[model samples]
Each structure stands twice: as C-alpha cells, then as structure tokens.
Target: MRYRDENKVLAIREAAIDMVASDGLENFGINRLAKAAGVSPATIYIYYKDKEDLLTSISIEEGVKMTRATLKGFDPNMSFKEGLWVQWQNRAAFSLDNHKSAEFFEQLRNSTYKDKMLETINDEFRKNMGNFVENAIERGEIERMPLEVYWSVAFAPLYSLIRFHNEGKSLGGRKFKFSEKIMKETFDCVLKGLTK
Candidate 1:
C-alpha cells in the first residue's frame, strides 16, 4: 500500500481542470492528467470513480469556491443597488484573481455534469441567496421575475467580459482593452434595466 498525500489529490484536481481547459473533454485522458499531476492513474482512481466522476467533483469544488467568494461580505439588507454592486465586485474580483480556476469553470459550464454541480451547491448558500432574492422582490427593488432571469440579467454581462478578458481577444478577434471602468459602467447599465 502507498500513501496518498492530500496535496497529490489537489494537484490531480487542478491538472484535470487544466487538461480539460486546454484539450477539451474529448481529448482529456486520465493518463495525461496523471502525468501532469505527478501522480499515477491508480491514485486518481482511488479518489474518483472515473473521468466523469472526477470532472463532476472538480465542477462542484470550483462552483463552491466561486460561490463562497461571491457571498462574502454580501448583505441582503443593503440597498438594492448597493447589494447588486457588491455582488458584481465580488464576482469580478474572483474571476480576476483566479484566472486559471475561472477558465476551468468556463469549461465546466459546458460539461455534462454542469447542471448536477449547480443543483448541488451548498445548501446554506442556496438558502441565503433565495432569501436575498425574496427579500428584494418583497421590497419592490426589482420586478417580479424568475430567479433564473435575475441571475442572467445581473451576472451575464460581467461573465461575458470576464471570458473575453481571460482570452485576451474580443469575440470578433479585435484588440480589446479591459478596465475596471468598463465593468462598473456595464454593471450600471444592467442595473438600470433591471430596476423598476
């Protein structure tokens, strides 16, 4: 029997994410990931049932980390606009701070386990988020709409910018300059349309 250090597990998780990001899921292989992580394939099997299972676990972990970062310093009782700005700031900071992890998250969004990972987020975080939405609606800060719509309206712009920024190219392949100014302006534009 051989010891499986937890760091090796972390390495495996990160390497798997990097592999999928660079190679796409179709080209991702456990053998290649093992070499990248400096661990054997058997070590990965010990932790995850299979490639699908490993990707699922990584998806869950990344979502939780990003969710937690987004929730920190979040106060549902704040003025509606302030709360929305805070959430945007948190999200932007996370995306900028963890470039590789954010890219991995982008890849996971297209994975088969995407919905499963989203449906299984931390219960407390989910509940708090629900409460925030409900409270905002009750206060008439936002229009009556499904949570999905709210999520799309609020975070979609930031994510769109993050994606392009991460790739260092615009959707049209033009040179693009990214700045905090653009993010704040984009948030204001989205917020104005969402508010009553």
Candidate 2:
C-alpha cells in the first residue's frame, strides 16, 4: 500500500496472481484481492473498472511475460533438434523457476476462462508457437503435422513435467526439479518422433 505508484500497481498484479494461483480464479473477487494486496477495495476500482477488467489485465500482462520468458535463449536458426532442445529447456526452466506464472498458465488451460481474457492470453503464446513451428516445417526441418497437432505433441510432454512437479512429485526420493537433463530427454523423444 505504501509503495511507489508503479510498484503499487505491480503489487496488485502480483497479489492477484498469488491469489489465483493459491485459490483459483473463481475465488478472485476484487475485495479479496485488494485485501490481499493491502489496499482498499476501492483502490482496485481506481485501477480497474471491475473484477473482469482486473483479470483481463493480469492475463494479458502475465501471458506476455511468460511468452517472452519462454522464448529466451531459443535460437531461431539452430538445427531443428537443437532448437527444440533449447526451447524445451528454456520453457521448462521458465515455468519451474516462476511457479506462479506456470500455475497461472495451468489455470488458463481450462475452458472455464472468461472468453475475452482467454482470447488475449491464448493469442499471446499461440502466435509465437505457431510461427515457430510453421517456420520449421516450411524449411523441411520439422515434420509436416498440422499446426494444432504439432502444438499438442510439443506442449503435452512439457505440460506433464510441469504438472507433476507442481503436484509435488519427486524422483528417486528427490524432488523433481526441472533440469537440462529432463528437457533434453523430452526434446529428443518428441523431436525424433516428429521429424522426418
């Protein structure tokens, strides 16, 4: 509440993310988030006209941030296998390192998402993903599967890994930290099956 103006807005967003990650979006009433953010509910009203407006803003902001983070360290010109490997590693590490963002995405995966918010969120990631795959296929570096089919195969494995870790699954009695080894293995298996 006492932070600088920009910082307060960020705190509101962060608090909203935490609330949704912890309690699910259905529980994200403005009063609840404002209290969690240590601001008056009216303060939230000042920044957002309503709860849906707040959610739309959060979804767009977080979605773009996640998309940017996912693309970090990915080489657009690498060999198909190498690009896939790096992408997997980057994507998993981004999700695991930023659990709230990961959880926020997981929540968005369900169809219960409000239509307008979901459209904005999906558009952010889907465009990058579509372009990446389309470019690879156009160059004959990757398989010719339909875009949606390719997306499903590419994202499914990583989704499982993230979900398992989020659910507190461990390996060999140790917690399953997202690692290069896991990313490499996942990428190898997926790309091998998808490539000519």
Candidate 3:
C-alpha cells in the first residue's frame, strides 16, 4: 500500500475546486488535475478511487463546510425576519469568501453529478431549514406557501445578486460591485415580499 500524504490530498482538493470553478466540470479531467496538484495520477488514486470519487468526495466536503458556515449563529426558532437576516449574512459571507468553492457547487448542481451529490447533503441542513420554515409560518411572520415558492422569494434574489457580484457585471453590461448596503436593501425587499 502507498503512504497517503495529507498535503497531497489538500493540494488535490484545492486544485480540483479551482479547475472546476474556472474551466468548468465539462472540461475537467483527472490527468489535468493530477498535473495541477503536482502529484502523479497514481497518487490521486491513493486518495480517491477515480475521478467521480474525487469530485463527489470534494463536493460533499465542501457542502458540509458551506452548511456549517451558513448555520453559524443561526437558530430555527428565531423570528422569520431575524432568522432570514442571519441566513443572508451567513450565506453572503460564505459565498464571497469562498467564491471558488461556491462556483464549483454551482457547476456541480447543474451537472450529471447533482443527483449523486444531493443524496449526501448534510441532513442537519435540511432539518434546520425545514424547522425554520415551519416556525416562521406558525409564528405568522411569513405567509404559508409551498417550499418552492418560499425559497424562490426568500433566497433567489440573494443568489442573483451574488452571481452578479461574482461576474462583476449586471444587466446592460454595467460594472457591478457588491456591498453590505446593497445586500441589506435587497433583503428588505425580499423580506417585504415574504411577510404576512
């Protein structure tokens, strides 16, 4: 058996994310990733069974990290407005600070691996979000609505803004910059639309 090195694993994971985020999953390949990680193809096999295994493992790890970051200091029992505000702040910070990982997730979600990855999403994330929505409806802080409708209204705008920020351009080819004030203003509009 070959000895496994932690540094090699970290390098492989980081290079995989950077390559996936920049060149996209369609263009990604194991040989290319091995070169980028400064490890032999066989070395990658030491840590991952194959390319699919590598991608799935990295995606699952990143998903867990994202969930932890987004749920930090958040409480499902909080008022709808307060809870949502916390979520927005947490999500924005995580997305911006780890834009490459965020981009990798976006690509993964749209790829064939999405269904495979979805099966491994942190159970606590689903449970907490579910509880948060139920609590909000029961408290009369937000109207009762389908989960899809609620998610669309509550989080889609934030994601759109983040996309614009990542691209550094919005509609009409205008240069774009993201700011806390802009995020807060957008959140207010979403909050208004969601409230009872």
lDDT of 3 by residue, 1-196 (tens): 6777899999999999999998888878889999999999989998899889999999888888888999999999999999999999999999999999988987898898898678666789899999999998898888788889988999999999999999999999899999999999999999999997
lDDT tens per residue, model 2, 165-189: 7877765556676556786688778
> 1 or 2, which is superior by lDDT?
1
Clashing residue pairs in candidate 2 are none
Where is model 1 poorest over a 10-residue stretch in terms of lDDT?
100-109
The candidates, ranked best first by TM-score, are 3, 1, 2
Residues 1-196, candidate 1: write the lDDT tens digits.
7676899998998888788777778788888899999988999999988988888888878888888898889987777788888888898899888887776766777877678777657787777677777777889988888878888998888988887887788877977666889998998899898988
State which candidate has the highest TM-score.
Answer: 3
**Candidate 3 structure lDDT:** 0.91
RMSD of 3: 1.3
Off by over 4 Å in 3: none
Task: Provide the lDDT at 44 for model 2.
Answer: 81
